[model samples]
Target: MQDNSPAQPAVDLRGVVKRFGTMTAVDHLDLTIRSGEFFTMLGASGCGKTTTLRLIAGFELPTEGQILISGQDVSDIPAYQRPVHTVFQSYALFPHLTILDNVAFPLRVRRLPRAEQRARAMAALEMVQMGRYGDRKPSQLSGGQQQRVALARALVNEPTVLLLDEPLGALDLKLRKEMQLELKDMQRRLGITFVFVTHDQEEALTLSDRIALMQGGRIVQLDTPANLYNAPQSLYAAEFIGETNLIPARMVSADHGSSVVEALGQTYRAEGTTASAGAAVTLALRPERVRREPAGTGPVGELVEIDFIGTDLRLTYRMADGSKVIVRQQNSGGIPPAIGERMPLGFETDSLRIFTS
Candidate 1:
């Protein structure tokens, strides 16, 4: 049969669902990944992120709904038959084969001519900056080199989409950071769709053009890194994307898109208006936004401890009501307050996010 799938939207999942016995792993999920875009699925373990990736790779069939690549349904298609490739976290290279052979294995399986396979393998190796190591066995290379070889093997197929499942999870911190940049660069140069799965929020924010935050088998939020960090839509999203301080507050009054909240026995004007009145709410504030001021100007608190974090300082203060609040200050110039010193903590009204609990 001639393949008549649309040559766009590298991947599209419509009402995708997967179940294991009585528990549903992926619940009625719908997603669309644009062609040539670097997309990421981020979530904790057992949140169905990997299951979604597996379903797209055809490693696991969905119980219901359709998986479309380029607009053609491939829900029941086997992994080997699909024009997709996966680079796993564990660099699954053949230890006995040379790097060149490992990269050429896929082409050989398709029975390509020897000359064509050799040329393609060398090119793939060069693309991953491993041309000189093509003659070396996978056992002889370092972890980073082996990972590059794995990536080269996946790229050699010239597949429509490349799925990476924590491909940098094995490398050291420095190497992982370097690889993140390299992978993004390679994706841009190749113009191929990349669906990356990672639980690290920093990695996702740094690498992906957009991220889908998964929670309990569903997508809680999907947006760019800046949007996800600056304006999270829910409590879970705010807490997950980065470090945040959640302060319990109550909406006392609101006017002209601004509301006043009573938090920690102090009334402060917040930026946004909420629908519910007399409701318990939480204000999401970043530690860096909380500023230290003179004791007489703002909320009074006693500095309990100061933590030196090399480039910054974290100050913990205890309010009269016995609530602990953390403030992160840059270590550029000003000397931090001594322990047991009294100070006023002031935060901008615009920085406060009022959300219903």
Candidate 2:
């Protein structure tokens, strides 16, 4: 008989909750990370992203619920017994040891043969492109190089899953971007499940196959980067992922997949809604989705301010009610509307996301 069932998730958190004295860090979170998937936990500081990572790492035990790895109940297991390794923001390498010895430290502690340790450690270094620096001391390498060595050390044991706790946060911006590409490539090539934690939304969008955006100790939204950005289910999800214009609106009517909302003294057809007729709602419109139309063609506003952002122009418009709406257009080297000039704004039907206030 052929087994057609889905494989077990590399890591799973079932009804997980973590409390710190009077505060709850993770509030009954149920999450499953599939094998070889790049899953990211994303949120601001104190949003429980890091706390969730620690719970999975066994550094912090959950106050309630079960933690599983490879379909096994590991809620009671200690960190050393878990089939996972964590790479922290700070590359915790021993300065006294050479790169090779640092990578071999884990195998050494496991009491593998000296030759086997050396061979495995060297292979791990090569995997991260730091093989040539095997003999160099940690102090002799640059920050990026040191981070690569640290990654090699973590990977040397070949754990089923790799937990990265903002491992690229310590690097400079340019280097961090470079490492992001490399990390994604490495994950794909090695086919290892990566459970990454980061507060940086851009980083999460760039590196994750799926992201869980957490807020107040719960996942506000969990989806692919594009869906999280384009089809945000809540105001928090829309506002957190990128720049958005929150227009005060009132729901006019609603159906299964669409809704009509009134905003800026005009009616608009918006994507899915959770509000009923005449209820107060909010419209989340991304700046880039806004179109500039001739004055009086659509919802009219006066251009109030303009800023030249590289590759794009950020324009602020003042509605009659004095509320401001921001619009972003690509820099095509054309003359922009003068400040104080009146212009109409256009929105595609799919661009407006309506949420109940």
For all predicted structures, in order, the TM-scores are: 0.92, 0.95
Could you give candidate 2's per-residue lDDT for residues 205-231 as a string of tens digits? 999999999998999998999999999
Q: Among these predicted structures, which one has the highest TM-score?
A: 2
Residue-level lDDT for 267 in candidate 1: 86
Candidate 1 residue-wise lDDT, 1-357, digit = tens: 112434478899999999999999999999988888899999999889999999999999999999999878999899999989999889899989999999999999999999999999999999889999988998899999999999999999899999999899989999999999999999999988899999999999999888999999999998988888887878888889888888888888765567888888788887654746667888888888898888546677899999999899999999777877789999986776799988888877667888788
Clashing pairs in 1: none
- Those runs of model 2 whose alpha carbons end farther than 4 Å from true positions after fitting are 1-6
Instruction: Please report how far candidate 2 places residue 125 from its true position, in Å.
Output: 1.6
Off by over 4 Å in 1: 1-7, 254-257, 271-275
Question: All candidates' lDDT scores?
Answer: 0.89, 0.91
Residue 195, model 2: lDDT of: 97
